[model samples]
Target: MVRAPFLFALLAAAPASFAQQATLSNGTMHVQEGTTLRFTGPLQFTIGPAGALINDGLIDLGTQAVVVEPVGSPISGSGVEMAVTATDGPFNATAPGGLGLSLTTNTATGPITVTRGHLARVFPEGDPSIARWFRLEAPGGGSAPVDVVLSYDATELNGLSGSAIGLYQSTQEDGPWSSLASTNDAAQYTVSATLPAPWDFITAFDQDAPTASASLVARNGVEVWPTLTHGPLFIQVKDGAALEELDLFDGLGRLVTPAMHQRSSTFASMDLSGLANGPYFLRIGQRTTIKLRKE
Candidate 1:
């Protein structure tokens, strides 16, 4: 009675963006039951205890952020689903960082299902500073009550004041968070949240400020490599710091490359092996942008 050899992967319906920081560190990433792993950004599923992640379909965590660690390796999806699309209209409230949520937004009124646990890691022991929680749940039988319009970047909320900017709710993910009931358009930084009927893991904390590490190349520590590579594509820049400007985009966002404006040193190697496989978007220096998958 031994059966454990069924692995499938079909995630190419167009819409798989990983703008830096993705670590699945081991193996076993079985997403083959219904097929759908539409990610847009932020991912970290280091399940090691034999490593296993059987997700059924639909895992669009577009607002970014996802962390599943060795919580004992248990992420079996019963048609597993999770979504985040709530970015409509004017949202550059003077933009500084963090505020680009999506999963193909039409201003979602649905798709927020995260049945059965395992997405944990807001800070599960290692705090790089703060801010690292991701959750979504609302698709079980009845399903209804997922109205989100959250947007934040009022200079990254440190200036607070959008009525304080809080909409935290949690059923325990190392959180006692409970604020929910929001609606602050503080000059269009946006915040309308409502998960009414017995909420299930929502996060947008700003108890005063601190949770906005908006990574302009991870705050200048910079390091980009093998983001699903096949050839040359490296950019280090840590203490050496010199590599300024570098642009290249494809995958509809256009801007094919031709903006290496000049100034390089701290280890830069971009020879994409001639480029022409799939996703691409790298805009280092003046405001980071990363997502390369030319394999």
Candidate 2:
């Protein structure tokens, strides 16, 4: 995915902010999870204890690679693999290392619109065997039913014939994963179910296969749209409370504090008294914020 914007308070607690590296006009810049962008320069976004930061060149991170994105540059990656090694930790990462996929663009001139309709999951954590857990959740704690269609590029791997693949969903990103869709072949799949509980879809491979090498796995490329959750509001939540705050930005993926949020479960209403009416994303986070547009 492209470098997104500020963090949503909801994402404040998540550790391990995945970093993405790409070169541009001004050297290398480090990026975190919800960073928004227009990098005419090289950037590497990394997330950790101190939070996410953008650096303008290659700094030696443990794993991962050094990707280059030149102006009008065509980006590509091969021998690309995610291997989750079986360790005594909470997650199992195997060979090839971790799962990962490169998010690129087809356009270079104007702004990019990436909605749930343009989400792609990159499993660069390597191979997740018997220990890969999945989770999902809706923004603003909005329990409204939304439909998300997830697809993956599995053409890079082989030997996954007859593998039982299914997607799981939930209101939270860490709970019992409910099955959304399933199949057994080599092709892109889609699910049309509504996640009333705020959800995410997980595609799983061989559940009990002993041979780790032959299990077929892939990343997610999904399209998500909130159905009954339509909005053109400005609001914020302050400890289970709803109020009006103006320090939010939208999908533009740039960082610049605007206003402040308050205590509200559904910060969906606001008064843009002095501001112009258009489209903006209400980004709430320590860094990676949830984006809601105001029109």
TM-scores for every candidate against the unseen true structure: 0.21, 0.26
Q: Give the CA lDDT, 0 to 100, for residue 4 in model 2.
A: 42
Clashes of each: 1, 81
Q: List candidate 1 stretches off by more than 4 Å.
A: 1-112, 115-162, 166-190, 193-202, 207-236, 239-295
Best by the lDDT measure:
1
Model 2, residue 198: what's the lDDT? 33
lDDT agreement of model 1 with the native: 0.47
Query: How high is the lDDT of residue 277 in model 1?
Result: 71
Candidate 2: Cα lDDT at 97: 18
lDDT of each residue in 60-128, candidate 1, tens digit only: 555454534454344554444454433432222211112222212222334343422223224211212
Shift of residue 48 alpha carbon in model 2, Å: 30
Quantify all predictions' global Cα lDDT against the true fold. 0.47, 0.28
